[model samples]
Target: MSNIAYLGIFGPGPNSSAAIVSDNEIIAWAEEERFNRIKTSPNAYPAQSIAFCVKEARKLGLEVTSIGYAWDCNSYSELATANLEQTIAKYPSETDHISRLAQQGLNALYNPTKVKQDLGLILRKLGIELTDQNFKFYSHHLSHVASAIYTSGFDEAVVIVNDGVGEVASSSLVYVDKQGTMKELATEELPNTLGGFYATITEFLGFKAYVDEGKTMGLAAYGAPDADIMAVFDEMVQTDGKSFHYTVDPRFRYSGKRTFGSRFTDLMVEKLGPSRPADVSAMIAPYPAIAYAAQKKLEEVLFAQMKYAASLNLSKNICFAGGVHMNCKANGLLAESDLYENYFFQPAASDNGVCLGAAFLAKIDETGEIPKLPSLEHLYYGPSFTDDEIENVLKQCKLEYVKSDNIGRDVAQHIAKNDIVGWFQGRMEVGARALGGRSILANPLNPDARDHVNRHVKNREAWRPFCPSLKKESFQGYFDTVIDKSPFMIVATRIHKEFLDVLPSCIHVDGTVRPQTVNKDINPLYWSVMNEFEKITGQSIIVNTSFNVQGEPIVMRPEEAIRCFYGSGIDVLAIGSFLVKKGRR
Candidate 1:
């Protein structure tokens, strides 16, 4: 039967979710907050996300059959040690909220019946039938493990997943075997979490906890790593190689509430005095220093865990999908190290990607083989519009525009001539990084391209480094020791000094670049464009940055691209089947 059997819904949190394994592919997949956009904890149900999935399934000409959540918070993992029913009864107030919010928020895990009700409402919204037999729950970390190890194109890989607390599981290690099957080596429940520690440090620095860690990562590149604070982190984080534990520097802990604790804040003050501090009057330079210190320490502990995991699993290759793996710089360090011969971090490393991971996991469970690797050619996963749709927006806006010349070729020539051109193609990508599909391309030789990009297009923090999409053949010659193959712009590796002038913009202050190695096999059009530019200019890579300016999402529509073209300092814009250039640039 082509009818979709198993379905799963995640609410985009470090909470318990549900998953079902049916005969065919993942029947329906979605997150709760993609519908509400407010997000839910694991205990919450994906009512809205489910509705959208049902709608999408209708588009696929199928009716959903079995519905499963990604969580067996019903069983036990981090959320409950053993008797989940008893645990909920132990916390009645939280349990009451669970009842009311089960359909929406993830409090369902705390209260089992609420979880059942949450699933009930999901089925109700779809106007579909359900059964106690149809309702199967999953363990949160098990879902995480299944999502990564099952899908990665590895016969055997050591898997690591970590995110905000779920089932009390802050970390886990999975060993996917040669048969495309895996077994859980061990799972680390919280009170010893790198993610938990990162979250606390994130909020301590005046940002939202789980959400602001990227901000802190960007902030870290600007600061100095103080030895004292380095000492603090060293003493606090203990690692056994396979997993880690974080003991907050008891002398200066703040429940990790504020961006800067009295002790940490004070340490910042003592180490690096106020740099232009009349505004806030605290030691600001040291904040990034502390952040750098924290990030550096976290990487050390994490790599230690990775190394231990490699040893335990005895897999030369390691595949990672977790919140901790989101730290690309740390990934870079791992790439440089000899711990794993091959390492792959899932592009959608965050929780949002888990939906795909869950579906992939279910596929793995059935096939017992690494589902054929979907070419990482591009990340064109979001919505796309047709010419009429684009033209309608264009006509409605009354914009001056005509579809221009051979877009890919002309833009390639322009890039060869050292011009910055915004190339918006196919669809916007699904993750944090922008691949070639939606990017700005330029000749990498221009030493001034970095500042030019910052001043004109990005207007982001000057210190935030630029990324390069390098030709696969020339990759090793231009960059020193680029062992990791990250077409996703996730790992930052160094630019060899001998070739610094060849691709100046791609080089960071620390002389590293988050390189996206392009090959005809991986991303053909993008590769061709870069290849054509390289042939003309004698340089094999292009300075590629996201196609959006500061304080804005990447321009989605053609008119938006035209608007950005005129408003920003971009010399050219590549719309589909056309080239639009600003006059007198």
Candidate 2:
């Protein structure tokens, strides 16, 4: 039989994305935000991403045999309707507005028919036909689980998924046996969600709910946990102290009319004080304290849930995915714990990653047997440009540039001279991180590097930390952690006390660093640059932030990288092997 290819789409939500898997290997993966230049690409159909995946499939002479969507909307409808009815019964006064919002959400999110129609139209535009028989939808939480466990290269592992509501379930504990059969051990359903709680707290602290939760996680490091705030959180969500199950107070989340807003009701404001205004500084005392308390509570509750998962005694390995797993601090806590002998945290532990899972499920459904595959080595599965393409863009922009005989050494020299370089290399990375493919590089030893990049390059909050991309050999020397490798920069760990002052720009206030440990075999070009930097500075690390400014997706094309280079304070643009420099010292 010929090889089978499956196309997966994750969309009509934030971070809409698409991916293609063929013969048990991922061919292409990309987010719609990168193509549309919208941050997170909320509720946007992933047409451009689908186009990319199709093009990549064609290049490999593979036809898409099936299409899989990341959500099973039909599974969510009844529970959603019942929840809405309960909410209306509880708050009769706000019934009208609540119903209106519910209807809007249904039309936008929970309508599978609309998604099918949109996919058909998009496929038709791409010279492909979509049929009901060839397309299937998988459960959202199950997709999250598969994204981690399937790519983990483990025959048997326990999977934990935590996110905002997915078909009524917010959290799930699942066990995958040696035969690749998955058993649902337990689940925490909607109205009692770790994700919703975190998002509500994020929004309450003057940040966007889904988009800025990372900001809250970062801000938490600056404040001491407040007992009063912790007490308030205890009232909102409580565990049984023996199981993975938990309960949420309906008044705080998605239940009824609020004194403040839809995310939180009068009960929350009455207990936690008024929500912070968007214009006010997030660095304010109470805000940080609130963030700290929220982070601590999240970790405490999550640890309890995982401890229960371990007690089930199913497997020695554990895998994690979902939007909530993107919290590196919480992931760091879990990494340090002795709950599981081996752990695999999905790099793209968000809705976008569901495409990978959906594709894998489709493959299993089509082939009748699970394909044994190697663990994911890297995420460089998106678009790439040749040297000719970079040169053409440079010539069109009328910019002076040069092809470097040794790109790594040249870039290293610029970085050592304290120049901020926009480094756009081979295929873009699939996840949220820059990962050397599309990165802005700076010298981490430069004390002013972090502030400069935050202010002039990224145009974001000064308190936000920049990640360090270091050689794999350098990981153990700098960070004190059990994680053997962190290629995705998704887990934060404490830096050694001796090296804390050495990497001033890379170390966060908490003395922890989210590092991308670069293996030479996976990315030789990036490793070569770090190697060259080590030769010059005697440290095998460099500051690596995504190649985008505030409120924009990471640069995808050569033109976008050029635009960003000229628009930002970056002093140099390294596209492929060619270099373009702004007139600077």
The candidate scoring highest on lDDT is 2
Q: What is the TM-score of each candidate against the true structure?
A: 0.79, 0.97
Model 1 backbone overlap count: 29
Candidate 1's TM-score: 0.79
Relative to the true structure, how large is the alpha-carbon lDDT of every model?
0.62, 0.88
For residue 573, model 2's alpha carbon misses the true position, in angstroms, by 0.8
Let me know the TM-score candidate 2 reaches against the reference structure: 0.97
Per-residue lDDT tens digits of candidate 1, residues 1-585? 354544565653542233333443433443343233342343345565566556656666766555445545564432443323433354333233333343234443445566677667668767876667555555656666666654465667788887755566777777877765567776666445777677756655555565547766766776686887777667656665444333334222322222334223333333333322324412365577767877887787778767777666478878777777778788788878777777777765666566555555544444443545533444554445566676676667665566755566677898776678988776556555678767888777888878888887776555566788877887787777748455788777777787776667777656677888886775676787877776687777888887777645556557667777777888877766656666672
Error of 2 at 378 (Å): 0.9
Candidate 2 C-alpha lDDT tens digits along 1-585: 255688888887888999999886888999999999999998688999999999999887888988889989766677777765665576454534766576568746767777788899999998878888889989998889888988998888999999987877899999988877889999987667899899998988888888889999999999896888889878888876778888777777655566677677777778888888877788987888889988988898889889999998888999999999999999999988998999899999999899989988888888777756678779999999999988998999999999999999999999999999999999999888899999999999999999999999999999999999999988899888988988899999999999888889999999999999999999999999999999999999999999999888899999999999999999999999899989855
RMSD of each: 5.8, 1.6
Give the number of the best model, judged by TM-score. Answer: 2
